[model samples]
Target chain A: MKKDMRSGFFALIGKAAGIVAVGAGLGLGVNALRADGLSLGATRPTVGDDKSTAGSCSAGPTTNVPEASIDEARALYGKPGVTFVDARSRADFERGHVKGAVLLPYEAAAAAAGQASLPVPTDHRLIVYCEYVNCQLSSLLAQLLSQSGCERVRVLKGGYPAWASAGLPTGTGP
Target chain B: MGERRAANGDGAVSESAATSGVSSSCAVTRFLEGPIVQIAARLALAAIFFYAAIPKIGDPAAFARDIANYRLVPEEMVSPAAVMLPWIELVTALCLALGVLTRGAALVCAVLLAAFTAATTAAVLRGLNIECGCFGQSGSGNAVGWGTVVRDAAFLVPAVLVVLFDRGRYGLAKAIKRP
Candidate 1:
């Protein structure tokens, strides 16, 4: 029994090491390949050429899906299939918010998203907005949501400030 | 008497094997006995990847530009990575969450997180102020780095854990029944 145990331990250790090495190697190879030069890709994604396009922010493919234009989102304001995540403090959310937006404070966004019970369907669009761009909360919140599996998540550029500044309707806090 | 001695040796070998296997088998059994936490961990890891990759997948050029900002990878691999990595993440995350090919999916995640760690480390060491591009950054170009490392490390823990002990909890691939 002890002998068998010794062999099993060695085998497990060997397999674990091999797995780590292979995993790390793949990482470095990808990194090294990108380090070689990065001008062309298999297919360049289409984007708004104007870097200054309002109501639009770049969504990295791996992180989150691209959001709709403000105009498009306007139609989705309270619509189904669009999960509006309010990335603000609980107190602030209680002050005012958009209709149908869930109260997922930036600090709590990760924990909120970690749950499998949250009804936000995997196929729905996820939009995260915070008080303002200078706030630094929304960027983190958006990323957290994406990291947590919100497939089509978008950070409202300049966040809630832009929306309020644009005179969009604000909902009463819960 | 010679046959008896040989039998005694065989018994010793079997005893050693039993001792070793017992410990590991106990752990595996313990997990199989109560796998709720393991299931949660796998799902959590899957969620993070899905979230991380979706934004980058959407605007690959933005992702490419963010990758470029790091100055870790060469200019060439950037675009392909931008294009494929997200899809890989999306698929892997899906596989993990759905409980399909859990082990394979976890391995893919470990690979992604490990790459992220290296790239983030390289960028920081070189003093690049670039955004990690795990989430595509805006054209603002301010550079985002350190946080990337921390986030990747955070993800790495769970991914590695799953690779180590999690076989399949909630999704289609039950350890007793690998997808």
Candidate 2:
């Protein structure tokens, strides 16, 4: 009886493994057939890396939305056609943000991408930023903006925290 | 039987009546432990998995972004995980709903729920204010919180019940075996 029970347990495990294998095969196969299929072996580019091809304006895809260095962003600050867009949460935006930056939280912008007019003008050179260096919200928001016909969208390297730490102008509330 | 007991004594007749009462209660217990409960649990798990998986399957890229936001997995693995996880969920859900490979499917569901709960808890602890991504990329507003962790943890109950108590009753497995 004990031996039978043990074998039955193993059989159940085998069945579970089989299910996983089958699912993975289907996933990869279907993904390969799709037009928008992801390259499983390729690494996604880190947004702010200076050496990353993602920073090049001519990079092939929306995923390669260009990034602006802190110095570049500072220079463009308060320029006539430049707009700073905060891509963090509303709470985070309220806590502290780039001086004169408009709140366009990534989640809200993503949901309203094609349907609604973006908070920032599409004709403006939009500089997006989130919380910190590792935060992907800025890049993600830039992609959305780029797709939404905002031609000059760029992620701000090191995000708002970096700007603040560097003693650049900052603001709080709404 | 009541008449037979009555012939012995009044006290014996009462005991016989009590025995019948106990037997009726046992029937109720059996009903509660039977296929109805198992089927209900299985269907609930299947529905949740289906709802969660379909959106992710449709847009793996957005799902990949959501996973990257978690900051848990390495960057390269994010795409592959995003590509495969929804399909696994979908297959597991199908198995659960159809009652084919019910035990294995339930076990997988339990494990997935446990993993989600752990990931959400970790995010909450680290104060990473990100989307839960429990459902999919459309879950933009569904921020990760301790409440999200509790909800995922709560889902484990049905998954586990399906694992331990499901006997393929009223399922495709049982129907296939009928001669």
Candidate 3:
């Protein structure tokens, strides 16, 4: 008989050994990862956030607007006492911003909770804005504001670029 | 007569050498190509991860409560970690299925499963009876027990398979062939 016939027995043994070795190796690896994840137990929460956990999603007095249309924000633009906050990076705010708009980046609000500069008062009607459609920081900021228990929090109808593109009042901020 | 004898010897030697070479190479090739056994293993793992997370994602706070119950995290971060954990699981799972970054993805998954298994083992030995909250609290909480460890170990099998035979049934590389 050809040696190939005997090869089958060796292949079977090889596969069985492969399976066991693989399982044991991964088992050890899982032990290590679990140890690490446990070590990281509290650290996971300190990382990325601002939504879902911000405020109670339902029955939590949230002024959450999943999405805002540009036209809707524009209509709200001139409303008295409505604060249009540009919830974008500082660079975008400096390059140009919506007229009467203020810069309050999302990270800043969360990072500096007690600072006076953040417009995070319980009484203020806050509107966080970002670039435009599909951008998330504005929504995220709005969510944070809601979680922090602001009286009213909303993202701008359209983000900053949308307002600028519409030829609305824009350019520099105090 | 001498020439005929010499030719016969050469022919036999070549035949034996070729047979052994083919036998060795086929086993290696099967491993490289990701035989059906490995494919089944990967698919099994993908299904487990993708579905295990649906309930948790739907109602994250419940999962947060579970995390909090672990008494492991600080008061502040509990909620945020609750929201992000499911997303990480979902993304890693999709990556495993796509076979993109197979090694890294498998390693991460192995890590995750191992973590779960450790928790399961810990719960079992420590006599701390609590809901694993792995799939979420569907309504009533189930007690943590040996079943959870077994379930997690069952899941661990495929992660090991992937790590050992990473080329996969449908991967981007093959073994070096000899002439």
Candidate 4:
């Protein structure tokens, strides 16, 4: 009886090992087939970069804007076509923000982007910024704006904190 | 083969003893090993793996990036893993769902679940606040957390159960050749 139990356990292990081997073999075959036909190496645009939009989609060329320092952003404070978009949450936008920055919270992109009375046109420049350097919201918004036909979309360097530290114009609520 | 012999051996022992307590324990084991319960466990695990694999298979690049986010696989190997893992999942899911080689399929599921649990646990401990990426990247990603580890651990139960009680009455494995 003892011998039978030991052999049974071994047989079970063997069966499992066989299944795993077959599964792995099939997986490799499928992967090879996919790689042969498709271009899988194209990397998506990551945050914190200065490059023109690759125009991988239907929308025509939209320049990927560079990260702007506090000084550079201040220069655009009163520029005619530049718009500062707050990419933080609504609560954070309410607590403080760039004086004329409009709230376009990253998660609420769809509703805000779909608004009929959005301040800027598709061709206008959008300056997006979030909490700080580590935050991804600003970069994500920049990518989304560029994809949505915006002519230029730049992320604010150091985000809102750097701007606030420079004593640039600040506002609270809405 | 070995499983049948052990059952026969147990039968002989139980008959010789004829004790109420031993017989009751055997009865409970038999109930738990019933075909209906085993098949249900197999199908449940199959459904989860299928759902996870289908979306991932459609976009290998996105899945590759998600794998990179975990920082577990080497950068060069990420692409291959991204391409292959989903296909393996799909195959194992099909096997479990169809009850073909159910023991082997269950073992695969158990191994995958164990790996996921380990990865998710490590990510949480390291404070890597990234998407769990169990499924394909969605609009809002699930953050790596203790909850994710718990969920993966819970999934292992069905897989382990199927592996143990796989001699269930209903299955392609039985149809092909009765053990």
Best by TM-score: 2
List ranges where model 2 is wrong by over 4 Å.
Answer: A46-82, A85-126, A130-174, B1-33
Model 3: chain B TM-score relative to the native chain B: 0.72
Question: Quick one: best lDDT, which candidate?
Answer: 2
Question: Considering lDDT, which of the candidate structures 1 and 2 is the better prediction for this target?
Answer: 2
* Tens digits of per-residue lDDT for model 4, B1-179: 23222233545543334455567778877876887778789889999999999878887755665676677876567776777688778888888888887777888889999999999998888777566779875323366789999999999999998887767467776777765
lDDT winner, 3 or 4: 4
Q: Is model 1 an incorrect, acceptable, medium or high docking prediction?
A: incorrect
| lDDT string, candidate 3, A1-174, tens digits | 568858844554454344334444543344345422222234222223433333222224455454546676677776876667787767768777877777877667656643433543345455677763434567667766665556466766556656778887887744
Give each prediction's DockQ, rounded to 2 decimals: 0.06, 0.32, 0.02, 0.19
lDDT tens digits, residues A1-174, model 2? 999999988988887887788888899999999998887863343433322222223333344678899999989998899999998878878889898998987767755644566668667899999875657878877876665546788999878767999899999998
CAPRI category for model 4: incorrect
lDDT of 3 by residue, B46-110 (tens): 67777866666666645665655454457667665566566556655665676645555566667
The C-alpha TM-scores of every prediction are 0.44, 0.66, 0.41, 0.59
Model 4 reproduced share of reference interface contacts: 0.27
Fraction of the true interface contacts (Cα pairs closer than 8 Å across chains) found in each model = 0.10, 0.49, 0.02, 0.27
Candidate 1 lDDT over residue span B1-179, tens digit each: 23222223545534545565667789776764346656876889888878877776556656765665565666567676666677677777777787766666677778778888898888788765445666654433334467668878888876767666764555664554654
Ranked by lDDT, top first: 2, 4, 1, 3
lDDT of 2 at A152: 88
Query: In model 3, which regions exceed 4 Å deviation?
Result: A1-174, B1-33, B168-179
Per-residue error for B50 in candidate 4, Å, reads 0.9
Lowest-sum lDDT 10-residue window in model 4 chain A: A48-57
User: Native contacts retained by model 1, as a fraction?
Assistant: 0.10
